[model samples]
Target: MYEGLMQKVMSDSKSKAGQYFTPRALIDSIIRLIQPQPGEIVQDPAAGTAGFLIAADRYIKDATDDLFTLSEDQGNFQRRQAFRGTNGCPTPTAFA
Candidate 1:
């Protein structure tokens, strides 16, 4: 719902939203298809807002019962190591 609203705002704006942002629905669909697993590294080299990485993390956590199925070490790895994105933003930060 929030992404939908963000999409609307981006589309309605005259800024470079189209260039910087992708529709969340598409991101969710791609993440669903990719089905990133634990231990597998997922990266977005040109990440704008890190949407793809965020969606992939959510998808994996949902599939893995919030990583309860993983060992503590594996879960830590998933939270910190599995998703990586490179961006030019001066204040890059994880969404979670």
Candidate 2:
């Protein structure tokens, strides 16, 4: 998983990664607190490796039973519009 990769990269070097990547635990905790829905617009401005955005999407999918509970339009929105990173960030999130 990309999260594993980032954690590996972080552990490999005591020095900080090129981009400021937040810890997965903290991100997941925040997502739990927020409880993002399928159609809400979620954007991370400083999306190093898109970790925050990815976690948010994962949280939403998990809550919605992998989007099975959502309507077609809501699922489409989750797939296309719910998760967003900054302009320079790569589209590295995996919804499934």
Candidate 3:
């Protein structure tokens, strides 16, 4: 859904929307270079559509299988500690 929406937006705006959406592969490469640790907070303060946060969350889960075995408290802490994104534009239509 977002892909189609992004395509339409980009086409309509003649590439102006490209600035707002980072390519997922580039996002993944940056996350790999940073190598976020388990307890460390990964935050994207100027997160547009939270692409970084989503990729980081996936990377962490793929790296750590302990998420399934952790106690409820530990799980809660991990969930809270990992991947925070702020200031995402609330409405997609607003971009248009």
Candidate 4:
């Protein structure tokens, strides 16, 4: 996904090349500061291949292994009751 974005950004002559990518070190630092949690929502207006979102997802999963251990039925019920009234959590399509 990031490779595709990078290719597009690099190919675009009108876009500011400097803004096309976020340094990995900086991304790691930001993830540490935000400390994402399970069942929490996160968004980035300028996601740029969703580095922040991905980092946050990994951080949350790593940080709260216990919290994420919901039984299958409990997890399904929680997902159905929350958000858009879906029957399942759908395995979290995005990082947040």
Give the Cα lDDT of each candidate.
0.75, 0.72, 0.67, 0.54
How many residue pairs clash per model? 0, 0, 0, 0
Candidate 3 lDDT by residue in tens digits, 1-96: 564576566665635534456677898899999887666788887675677877787777777785765667766777986666666444353222
Which lDDT tens digits does candidate 2 get at residues 1-96?
A: 676775665664524334445777898899889887777899876666677787888888888999999999989988988877764434332321
Question: Residue 6 deviation, candidate 1, in Å?
Answer: 7.6
Model 2 deviation from the true structure expressed as Cα RMSD, one decimal place:
4.6
Listed per candidate, the RMSD to the true structure in angstroms reads: 3.9, 4.6, 3.6, 8.4
Worst 10 residues of 3 by lDDT: 87-96
Residue-level lDDT tens digits of model 1 in 11-95: 6452543344677888999988888888899999767667898899888889899999999999999988888888654332333
Q: Score every model by TM-score.
A: 0.72, 0.71, 0.70, 0.56
Q: For model 1, where is the 10-residue window of minimal lDDT? A: 87-96
Q: Rank the candidates by TM-score, best first.
A: 1, 2, 3, 4
Model 1 clashing residue pairs (backbone)? none
| Candidate 2 colliding pairs, count | 0
Where in model 1 is the C-alpha error above 4 Å? 1-18, 89-96
lDDT of 1: 0.75
Model 4 ranges with Cα > 4 A deviation: 1-18, 66-96
